[model samples]
Target: MKFLIAFLAVVAVALAGPIDERGAQIVKYTNDHQGISGYNVEVETSNGIRTIEQAELRNLGNDNAAIVVRGSYSYTGDDGQVYTVNYIADENGFQPEAAHLPRA
Candidate 1:
């Protein structure tokens, strides 16, 4: 998720428009984190971009546990369509569901 944020920052800078103008700003934000326990985050921007995520630690017993995370993010495209992706990451690995993703 951190990598995704970084990549988006780079892309935003590259397409930030005029040099003298500021880019999109945050319109709303919320975060609740408790270290390994888990976290929940939500954010919205001046542009039509929004992200929401929630995660929790689940114990599998016998001193084993894992963090289960699920989230979805959406952004307005140049063509005026809103693109969104829903994903999950846990013991099974990353799984993303979106119309643009190719099927196996």
Candidate 2:
């Protein structure tokens, strides 16, 4: 029983150190002046294709972040439509507004 307890304690300590370091790195990155970061994705559908482009800018000092996204859905035989949205995230939460969202 003693040997098992000692082994578990050692394992716990080793795991805790790495977790702390990773958490610190995450905090630092979120607080730094990083340029826009995002990705683009494309998908194919039976009727047509869809593409999405998104980017985000972070202002950790102000505890705020901004995001912009644009997407398009094209039909195989019909003209496609594109939509755009802007978002701001702060301590409160994420607030999004559509710049060119289609209405049903």
Candidate 3:
């Protein structure tokens, strides 16, 4: 019984470390977009297709996500369209539209 408990404790610590690391990654991504206000891109992955919206992005500083500027992107061409966009992060930052971002 003692051995089982010790093994469980070790397993819990191992699992906890990864969770903290993932949480830190999320914070890094969120902080990377801080104070951004105006026309910005949003990236998301879905079951059917990936999505990128050219909406006004605002850094609300909340964990959920950076705020999307309300009602400002209704007429934008890429406003509501869904696409197979892949959001790749590099040394520069989050590249929602890989094609549009200039190659370094």
List the pairs of residues colliding in candidate 3: none
Model 2: runs farther than 4 Å from truth? Answer: 1-36, 58-61, 76-104
**All candidates in order of TM-score, best leading:** 1, 2, 3
* TM-score quality measure for candidate 2: 0.31
TM-score per candidate = 0.72, 0.31, 0.24
Clashing pairs in 1: none
Residue lDDT tens for model 2, 1-104: 99999999999989655222223221111122235565455544332333333445446346455554444443232233444444544445656566454444
Of models 1 and 3, which has the larger TM-score?
1
Best by TM-score: 1
Go through the candidates in order and give the clash count of each.
Answer: 0, 0, 0
Q: Which candidate is the best by lDDT?
A: 1
lDDT of each: 0.88, 0.46, 0.39
Ranked candidates, highest lDDT first: 1, 2, 3
Which residue pairs clash in candidate 2?
A: none
Worst window of 10 by summed lDDT in candidate 3: 23-32
